[model samples]
Target: MKQYSRVTNGYTVVDDVTTRPMVRGHNFPAYSFAANFKYLYLIFATDTPRYDYATGYLSTEGKILRGLKPAR
Candidate 1:
């Protein structure tokens, strides 16, 4: 989500809804994940009989992370 504000100076200020790290500790389920200049792809063992496995993406800075189902 993005938010904008108007000021008398004829300029608009913009802000976006984003999430940062929650717990202050070293994370990333495993050590050997795939990465490049911008993003990373990793598998998270869901450990659930139904889900089985899942996918995750993280920015290089590890700030923007999200989860999704792997493509069949």
Candidate 2:
């Protein structure tokens, strides 16, 4: 598993995996169940107005984020 964040670009990255050890000396039945895993990433950006008078002006901004859920 690995995780990293870049402040300069306001972006985040994550990598991960889930695995189960094979049953030892067992052949009657073989199966594996999900252990529940999730991942998320986010990025942000901002801009400033060019005019000083716009400082008090109301502004709207937007953001984007990604989310992942474990397989059922």
Candidate 3:
């Protein structure tokens, strides 16, 4: 298993080893109409092997977004 450190503006991150991707998006509303709220939009962009492997449940994909907060 590999470890990583990421910084976000005002969101929260949780780790799930039993799960394949390891990280996922939660609390993000599907539709909105604000630019600043754009940060609330969670997007995952992975490459071929990386994407396949991540989707295949091998490696993990780092989470990226706005409104993220550190773990307590």
Best-to-worst order by TM-score is: 3, 1, 2
| Residue 27 lDDT in candidate 3 | 38
Per-prediction TM-score: 0.17, 0.16, 0.17
Q: What lDDT does model 3 reach? A: 0.35
TM-score of 3: 0.17
Per-model C-alpha lDDT, please?
0.34, 0.24, 0.35
The deviation in Å at residue 17 for candidate 3 is: 2.2
lDDT of 1 by residue, 18-70 (tens): 43422222233232232322232223433535332234445555433547555
lDDT of 3 by residue, 1-72 (tens): 113212353343335556765674453332322322333232333432433332333212223333444469
- Best-performing candidate as measured by lDDT: 3
Q: What are the root-mean-square deviations of the candidates from the true structure over C-alphas?
A: 15.0, 17.6, 17.2
Name the TM-score of candidate 2: 0.16
